[model samples]
Target chain A: MDNVASLMHGFSVALTTHHILLMMAGVLLGILVGVLPGLGAPNGVSLLLPLTFSMDPVSAIILLTSLYWGALFGGSTTSILFNIPGEPSSVATTFDGHPMAKQGRATEALSFAFLSAGFGAMAGVILITLLSGWVAKFALKFSSPEYFAVYFMTFASFIGLGGASPLKAIVSMGVGFALASIGMDSVSGNVRLTFEFDALLGGVSFLIAVIGLFGIGELIITMEEGLKFEGVQAKVRISDVLRTAAKLPRYWVALLRSSLIGIWMGITPGGPTAASFMSYAMAKRTSRNPAKFGKGEPEGVIAPETADHAAGSSAMLPMLALGIPGSATAAVMMGGLMIWGLNPGPTLFTDRPDFVWGLIASMYLGNVVAVIVVLATVPLFASILRIPFAIIGPIIVAICFIGAFTVASKSFDIWLALAFGVVGYLFKKLDYPIAPLVLAMVIGDKAEDAFRQSMIFSQGSLSIFWSNALVSTLMAIGVVLLLLPLVGMIAQRLRGRTAQSTV
Target chain B: MITRFWAESATAVATMAFGLIIVYGALEFGIGWDSSGPQPGAFPFYTGLLVALASLGTLALTIGRRIAGNAGLQESFLDAERFKRVASFFLPLLAFVVLSVTLGMYVATILYLVFAMRFQGGYGWLPSLATAFGAAAFFYLALEKFFQIGLLKGPLEPLLGL
Candidate 1:
C-alpha cells in the first residue's frame, strides 16, 4: 500500500508541465538518435550528459529515461522498415518485421511492435514498483564483503555467460580493470598509473571511454561496412493500427510470457538483447505453427519487442535498488546518477524517494508518449534511412569528438576518444566481447573500494568473505559462475568420448 | 599482413606483457600486508596476475589450435576491397581531428564535410558545400548559443568577432 501511495506521489511529480515537455523532447531526440546508425542509447546519453550537468537531477533523469524509451521504439521502426536493427535488442525484430513490411503489412507490424513494447514496459514498471521495496530491504543488509561478491558475480557471469569465448571476455575485463585503476585512488588518495602525466591524474573518465568505445568505435565499423541506408517504403494507417491492436488480445499468453522473461533477464545480467532472443526462441518452440514464424507472423514481432522493452525498462530496477546496473546503458545512467550527487542502491530508496518514484512515474508516461510520437511520425523517421551514409558518418564522428571534449572541457579527451576508437574497432574485428569491458570499466572503482574495505575489516584475511552465510553464498555463486565454462567444456569432452566408445 | 590467428596471438602476448608491467608497478607501491591490513598494491597486484594468467590461457588456446592444423591462419584480417573502403573514411577522420585542433570545430567540420560528401558520397560540389555550411551553422547555434557549452575555438573566432 505504501508502494502504491509512493507511486501516486511520483505521478504528481512527473505530471508537471515542464517535466512532460522534457519527456516529449527527450523521446523525440531519442528516436532520432536510435534511427541514426552509430549513435545508440549509451552514446546518446553520453553525448547529452554534459548538457544535463546544470539541470535538476529529476528533470535530467526524466529526459534521459524518456529518450531511452524513444530509442527502443525508434530501433523497432528501422528494423521493420529497413531490416537494419537500429539497436542490438531489435535484431530479432528484423527476422520477421522486415518480412511483414515486405508483404505490405508494415502498418500492422509497426502497430504490433509499438503496442507490445508499451505493454511490456508497463509490466516491467509494475513489477519494479512492487518488488523494489522488498529488494531494497534485502540489500540493506549487505556488507562490503557481500557487495564485493555481487560485483564479482557480475564480472564472472560476463565471462561464463557471454556469447564470446570466455578467455576473450576475461581479457576484455582485465583491460577495463587496468584502465580503471588509473587516476587518483579515492580511498588512499594516492595516484597510480598516471606516471606523472597531468591529464592522467583525474583518471580516465568512464563517459569518455563510453563515447569513444560505442560512439566513435561504432562509426569506424559502419564506415568499414560501407553503410547504405536505402530501405523499404510503407504507409502507416490509423485503421490498420487499430485493427492489429484489436487482435493483440489473442497473444496475451505471449505478451505475459515475454514480459516475464524480460523482467527476469532485466533483473539479472542477461539484459534486453538476451531477453529478446530468449523470448523469441521460447515463442517459436511453443507456438503451434512454428513453420510460419519467419514468414511475417504477428507473434514474431510481438514476442521480441515485448521482451526488449520489458528488459530495457526493468534493467533500471537493479540500478535503482542495488546500485548495480543490469546492462551497459543502465550503467551509464547510474553514472549519471552518481554525477548528480545521488547514490544508488538501498540508500537511493531511503534518501531520494522523490527522484526514484518520479523516474518510475515518468517511465509510464514516457512509453505512452513514445508510442504516439513514433506512430504519427513513422514516415519522417523512416526517411532518415534514406540519407547517404557518407554524409552521416563524418557528422557522427564530429559529434563524438565534441561530446568527448565536453565531458571535462579538456582537449586531452579528444585524443583519448581517438585511441579508444581504435581499440574498439580492433576489439570488434577480433570478436572480443566489449560489454564486459565497458561494464567493468564503470564498476571497477566501486568494486575495488568494496574489496579494500572488506580487507580492512578482516585484517587481510580472505576468509572473511566466507564468514557469513549471505556473503559466503554470494561468493560461492561467483566462483561457480566463473568455473561454469570449464565444467561445461570438460563435460562435453567426456560426452564425446563416451559417444565414440559406444559407436 | 597478419592472419587472424596470429593477430589474436599477438594481442594475448601484449596483454601478458602489460600484466607484467602492472605487477612491477604494483610491487613499487608495496603489496605486503601490515597491521593496517592489505596495502594499496595488493588488489592491483592480484588483478594484474589474473589478467596475465587469462591472457596466457588465450594464447595457449590459439597455439594449440595452430599445432592441430585448425587455426585457420589463411584468413587475413581484412580483404582488399573492405580495406579500401575503411581507409576512405578513416583517413579523412584522422585529418578532421588534426584540422579541428588547428582550425576550430566549425571550419574543420565544413571542410571535412565538403571533402567527405564530394569524394565518398559522390555528391556535387554545390550541394556538398551548402549542406556542410548549414550543418556547421546549426551546431554553432545549438551547442554554443543555446547549450552555452564552449567547444574548441581557433584564430577564426576573433576574425568573426561575434
Candidate 2:
C-alpha cells in the first residue's frame, strides 16, 4: 500500500513538464553515446557527471538515470544494424541480431529487441518497487561490520567469479585501493600518497579515472584500428514495429526466464554482461533449434536484449538499497551520490523518499519514453555511424580532456587523465579486468573506515564480525567466495589426473 | 621483444615493486594496534602484503609455464604497422594536452582537429576547417553561454571579447 502511494507521488514528480523535458534530453544523449562504438554507458555518464553538480540533486538524478536507460536501449541499435556492440552488455545481442540483419530482417530484429528491452525493464522496475521496502527494513538493522561484510562480498565476488584470473583481479583491485588512499584520511587527518605535490592533496577523482580509462583509452585503441567506420544501413517502418510487438508475445517464456536471470544477476555482483550471456546460453541450450541460435534466431535476439535491460535496471536496486553498486556504471553513479552530499543505502529510502520514489518513477517513465524515442529514431542514429571515425576520434579526445578539466576546473586533472589513459590502454592490452579496479577505487576508503569502526566497537577483537548471525553469515559467504576459485582449480587438476590414469 | 608471458611477467614485477613501496610507507605510520583499536596503517599493511604475495605468485606461474611450438619465448608486442598507427594518435594526444596549456583549450581543440583531419585523415582543408570551427562554436555556446561554466580561454578570446 505504501509502495503504491509512494509510486503515485513519484509519478507526480516525474510527469512534470520540466522533468519530462529533462528525461527526453538525457535519454537522447544516452542513446547517442550508446550508439557510438567505444563510448559505453560508463564513459557517457562519467563525462556528464560534472555537469550535474550545478543542478538540484533530484533533477540531476532523473537526468542521469534516464540517460542510463537510453544508453541501454541505444546499444542494441548498433548491434542489430552494424554487427558491433556499442556497449559490453550488448555483446550477446550481436550474436543473433547481426545475423538477422544480414537476412534482411533488420527491422524485425530491431523492433523485437526494443519491445523485449521495454518488457524486461518494466519487469525489473516492478520487482524493485515490491522488494525495496523489505530490503530497506532489513538493511536498517545493519551496522559497520555488516556494511563492511557486504563490501567484502562485492570485492570477493569480482576475484572469484569475474571470469579473469584471481591473481590479476586482486592485483588490479589492490592498485585501486592504493590509489584511493592518496587523498586526505578523514579519521586520522593524514595524507599518505600525495608525495608533496600540490595537485596530489585533493586526491584523484574517480570521474577523471573513468573518463581516462574508458573514454580516452578506447579512443587510442580505435585509432590503432585506423579510425575506420563502416556499418550496415538501416530502415525501419512503423508497421514493422507493430508487427514485431504482436509477435513478441510468442516468446514470453524466453523473456520471463531471461528477466528472472537478469534480476538475479543484477541483485548480485555478476552484472548485466554476465546476465545477458547466461540468458543467451540458456536460451540456446533449451531451444529446439539450437543450431539456429547464431544464425538469426529470433529467440536469441529476444533473450539477451531482455536480460541486459533487466539487469541494468535491477542493478540500481542494490545500489539504492545497500549502498553497494552492482556494476561499474552503478559504481560511478554511487560516486555521484556522494558528490551531491547524499549517502546511498537504506537511510536514503527513509530520509529522502521523494528522491528515491522520484527516481523509481522516472525509471518506469524513462523506459516507456526510451522505447518510443529509440524506435522512432533508429534511422537517424544509424546514419550517425556513416561519419568517418577519424573525424569523430579527435573530437572525442578533445571532449575527454575538457571533461577531465571540468571535473574540478583544474588543469592538473587533465594530466592525470592522460596518464591514466596510458595505463588503461596497457591494462586492456594485457587482458586485465579494469572493472574490479574501478569498483575498488570507488569503495576502498569507505570499506576501510567501516572496518576500523567495527574494530573500535569491539575493542580490537576480530570476533566482532562473527558476534552477530547476520554479519557472521555475510562474512562466511565472502570467505567461501574468495576461496572458491582456488578450490575449483584444485578440483579441475585432480579430475584431469584421474582421467589420465584411466586412459 | 615481448610475448604475452613476458608482458605479464613485467606487470607482476611492477606490482611487487608497488607493493613493497606501499608497505614501506605504511610502516612509517605504524601498523600496530594502538589503545584506541587498529592504527591507521593496519589495513593498508594487509593490503600491501596481499599485493606482494599475489604478484609473486603470478610471477612464479608465468615463469614456469611452457611455450608451445615455434612462437619462441618472446612475441612482438605489436606488428610494425599497428605500432605506427597507435603512435600516430598518441603523439597527437600528447600534443593536444601541451597545446591546451599554452594555446588555450578552444584554440588547441580547433588546431588539433584541423591537423588530424588533414594529415591523419587525408582530407582537404575545407571540410576539416568547417567541422573544427563548428564544434568549437557549439561547445562555446553549450558549455559557456548556456551552462555558465568557464573554460580555459586563450589570448584570442579577449581580442574577440569572448
Per residue, candidate 1 scores C-alpha lDDT tens digits across B3-43 of 88877888789888877777777777778876666677777
| Candidate 2 wrong stretches, greater than 4 Å | B67-76
Give the clash count for each candidate: 0, 0
Q: Which tens-of-lDDT digit does each residue in B23-125 have in candidate 2?
A: 8877877888887667777777778888888899888877766343435335665677888888898999999898887878899999999999998899999
Interface RMSD per candidate = 1.6, 1.7
- Predict model 2's lDDT versus the native: 0.87
User: For residues A419-449, could you state the per-residue lDDT of candidate 2 as single tens digits?
Assistant: 8898778778776788887888888888989
Q: Each model's DockQ?
A: 0.67, 0.65
Tens digits of per-residue lDDT for model 1, A48-139? 99999989999999999988988889899999999888888999999899999999889999999999999999999999899898899899
Q: Which lDDT values do the candidates have, in the order given?
A: 0.87, 0.87
Q: Candidate 1, what DockQ?
A: 0.67
Residue-level error in angstroms, candidate 1, position B114: 1.5
Error of 2 at A119 (Å): 1.4
Cα shift from native, residue A500, model 1 (Å): 2.3
